[model samples]
Target: MGNKPSFGETDLPCPQPRQFPMLLWLLLLLILPPGRDQSGVTPKAFLLLNPPWSTNFHKDEVTLTCRDSLSPAQGDIYWYYNENLLNKKSEEIQIHKTGYYKCKTQRSSLSDPVHVDFSFDKLILQAPHSVFEGDEVVLRCQAREEAKEKRFYRNEIQIQSNFTLQSVSMNNDKYHCTALVRGFWTWNKEISKHLMIQVQELFSPPMLIASPSSPTEGSPVTLKCETWLPPQRSHIQLQFCFFREDKALGKCWSSSPELKLPTVWSEDAESYWCQAESVTPPIRKRSLRSQLYVQRIPVSDVTLEIQPPEGQLTEGENLLLICSVAKGTGTVTFSWHREGTVRSLGRKTQRSLSAVLQILTVKESDAGRYYCAADNIHGPILSKLIRVTLRIPVSRPVFTLTSPRMQAMVGDVVELHCESQRGSPPILYRFYHENVTLGSSSVPSGRAVFKFSLTADHSGNYSCEADNSLGVQRSDRVILSVTVPVSHPLFTFSPAVPQAVAGDVLELRCEAQRGSPPILYWFYYKNVTLGSREAPFGGGASFNLTLMAEHSGNFSCGADNGLGIQHSEMVILSIIGPPSNKTTLITEGVTAGLLSILGLAVTAALVCHFRTQRNSERLSTTGTPSYSPREFKEPSRTSNTNPQEPLDPVEPQPVYNNVNPGDSDLVYSEIWSTQHTNENSANSPRKHWEDKEPTVIYSDLKKAYPDDSTEQASIVDSDLEDAVENYENVPCVLSALDR
Candidate 1:
């Protein structure tokens, strides 16, 4: 054994088997350091780990240290593993791999090596190569062996522990792992594994929708179903289904999501929805519900009909019309129209109905085209036109006379009649004169007649009016004339003596007090008329003619005016001869003169007597005479010729006187002769005695003395003279004597 066999530098398996020899060798080696103390002086360095040992994988770490004395002199230090340099460091070295490691300081003189075993060290995984946003990448730090706990480290920072394997999200970074053994230093190692994670964006389903906003009822509608998707998905085929009330409509598949129907009716009203589908994994069913409203369109079948049909209507008749609907519903309003004017008849709102319009007592004004209309709340609908006609009956009318022929005279009668043919019933007839209503009689079947007596007052226009309900119609005007009867006539002669003289014109006029037009007058003078004339609308008629001896006769006049003839009172015309110019002589011997004288005296006396009688009668009848004579004077001289004898009362006297005288000489001639002769003698010779004394006469011996008879004559004469004197002086003179 002395020999441990010199084990220096020997490669023997049992070299250390014998300790004595090994110790002797190490002692020798130690003693022998004369060669350069190659065994590094006990290194003044300490090994340092960044993180403490833990069981977690991400918390493990290891550090190799080679601290040299002298404040780590500036010299390259070589880190060695098993006496081989693995890395060089000035101060320390880090180890990321899970393995046993030792650090040595190599200089001109070698340093003691610091040995570390990282058997429980963790290996850390680095960040991935590439990673996208929102991606999960695993970063693992695994320990070489299970440790009580593992800790991970990044750039000397400690991580969570308590795990055999630690993981972290990747962020493109290099990573390392470290682990700790219960009774040893921490061990850690970096891994070369890198991860590259790529992140992708998620896709969402497309949105589908319908269009057309809001739709109305009964209107044509279009539905649109559309979706918005990424442009990259445009090529994908898509199908859409439009549905209403959970029912599919028509063909559901279409390139576009819109459905179009030309028109919609009330029956098509419902809630609507749509769906869009694609070949993609998840089908898109996007829908919206919309309400569809249906509206009713009013029908237009309104008619108007008149109840009685339009025809001629009389006054006080009723008018009726009806408004009906053939096809309509809802509130129906009925209105009647006349002449384009509307009238409210009646209305029914609950249901469709009819309306009746009645107009009582129809008149002429009610005739017109009548129509009705039916209306719902929607609009007014007109009906067919109906014509209405009204008829008016004739009414009872009055009649009047329109002519001026009402009043008529005797022998003249006027006819007046009135007609009212339009009246309902036949009318009776009556006549009126000066407002006097006449007896009523049947009007016959035609014209009525009335007769009026002709009279002066009848000279007026007559009028007649026809009576009917329609109206009173007057006839043409008429005039009437009445003829009057002639009145009694009177006639008288101008010269009232005996008759009218010859060559005298006798006028005869005939007249009547009253008559009508066209009066004819005829005049007669001495039974003959000079001319006949007519007096129209009469006054009087006259005739003038030259009277002749033959014309003396009874004359009369005739008057006629168509009514009757009238005659005037007759008048007689007379003609007489004038007296002769011979004179008569009256004497006591009955001479012509004497007889004439005596006759004149007697005639004068008789005429006086008769005249006195006539005067007395006139005075008695008329009460008094018009004239009377005053007292008369007697003869002054005593008459010598036995005074003129009184004239015989019976004999008539001549109107003329004659005288004869003879010349005498103192012959005692009668004093009357003497006075006469003296008077004649006193006158001139050219003046005749006849002119001087026309009635004076001298009897032959005029102075014969009177005997006693003369005395008696004287006495008689005296008495006669006294009587004449008394008679002449009397105050009571005869009326004839006065005249």
Candidate 2:
């Protein structure tokens, strides 16, 4: 304010003229932030040449460097050729190649203009000429200059870089070159070369094969897998896999070219293929498909059976059998067999769907177990077993008689029978006796009968039997008997010459020597029965009858044994009457007379015989003396009164010499006595002849009385002697009658 004196007038402080505001303004300005320059820190600039490098000149080195405006310092550098990466050091890189190139620094700065001029005699990329699809190949970049390091790159990627004397590898392509020093410049000459690679095909995979080119249906088959490779590559290790359609069969790794599977069935057959792969890299495939065919085997069911249903079979009957098959195809073989035997009855083959067998006519041996089998290629198959059996029946029989006495006499008969029980049909029966077969007959059902007439020879035991297919049976024994009858009888009589007198009896007898039983007999004379009697045992019968005129003629007898009557032979009998009455008187009076007469006659006869004998003796001895005078007297009777009569009387009577002297004497005495009586009578009376013989009569009277009496007595004695003789002859007469 001191200076403030001037304050009012303008130059006085020219105001310190706005010094008044300058203070404020200068202070404000000092407190405000500093202002910055608009342009950045000195910008780093670089240049990249196109197609950066070439190796056209011999022993040429390509260098590429990056220059920066900043101080020279070490930094990471990158190089590129086209879009590929390159190796670098210190913001620089070295290369020997023909390629596009570029570079950068690690300081976040751009390099100076990049130069790609590097001359090489040639550019080369190391890669395989041929490789599999997935094989690995490498490309390397190198320089001809011996002292220069080499870099490797591919497709803009950085690879390692070797020292000047080392080699490097580059698997991918892209590159650039650079110098190790900073800011080293190269001309902008660039050249590019491309690497070439090729890929080749792998070995085709293996093929699969099957055996039995074509197989029958249902038959077994085999399959095989095989592969082929180049002769040089055949030893290469490879893995093989086999497939059928989508299915994997199996895997095999071996030097051999083939694989095999045995006995494949139908289901295993299909299209088949194979593959081969190297152990290291790419896998390769090849395949072959083949159509497969499978064939079918024949099949069948066989059976055996019997006919006529069920039942036991008979021997000699017909039998039937059959064999058959149900299902089969193609040719089938059939055979028949018996169980437990290795042999077959028969065999046959047929293409037909069905088969059969038949058998007929059976025997006992035909029965057995039977079976059948069928086959094609498959096998022989067996059927169920069947069984058979057999049977038989019986025959006929015969009968005979054995008992009740073999021989029968009169009325008798025999009985016989035959039978057959067990036979099929028509049985014959026969009967026999005494080894003679009688007759035969047929019996359809059972039995037969026979009757025989009895005979004497039928006497023996007989047997019968029957037979058929079954056997024979015999019958018991049988027998027979017979009978006979009686015949006529005979009779005879004895003394049949004349009549049988009184006191005599005639005998008549009847006999039957041959007859059967109790015989009744009767004796008859002239049809009258003397007596009725029975000779029970059949001997002769006798009848006695006093001789009578009425009982005398035709005597006979009859015999009967109750069977029939038999008459005996006829006989004749004669009867005579006793001596007449007159004869009786002459012979003898009743009783005493007859006796006396007989005695007297005997005495007289004796006296006469003695006198005769005496006389004869006296004549010889006493000479004529003492003869009875009556004996010497001779004829006293008349005799016609003549000399001749005397002479006739006088004639000596001749004596019978055969007569005894006693007999002669008796005779002479009788005659002399009669003569004396006659002489006396003749003299006394010459009256009647009857009277004239008075003396004779007187002599005759004596002679007559005595002679008559004697005669009677002799006759009586004779009769008695005859009766005794008759009595003795009676037995003889009876015996003759019996004969």
Compared with the true structure, what per-residue lDDT tens digits does model 2 show for residues 1-739?
0011111111111222323343443344334432212222222323322223222344445455554334253455555454345554555555555544444444323322222333432333333332333344444454332323344444544456531211122122244432222123532222234432322333434455666766654344455544433222334466666566777664555433445554443444567665555554434455566777655456556777666556266556666556666765446778888777898877888655445555555555666788888886678777888876654333325454533554344446556777654554455565666557877666666677776776545656665665443444566656543333456778866554546776576666678877655677888867877787777765777777677656657878888866677887786666766778866876665677667656645544444455455557668897884522112222334555555443333322311111123423222112211122235544522233344321211111111122446543443454333322211111112112111
Q: Which candidate number has the best lDDT? A: 2
Model 2 quality (TM-score): 0.23
Sliding window of 10 residues with minimal summed lDDT for model 2:
1-10
lDDT values of the candidates?
0.48, 0.49
- How do the predictions measure up, each by TM-score? 0.29, 0.23
- Candidate 2 regions off by >4 Å? 1-121, 130-138, 142-192, 209-234, 250-256, 280-291, 295-739
How many steric overlaps are in each model, in order? 62, 55
> How far out, in Å, is residue 573 in model 2?
99
Question: Where is model 1 more than 4 Å wrong at Cα?
Answer: 1-415, 421-447, 451-459, 467-473, 485-498, 503-505, 563-565, 576-739
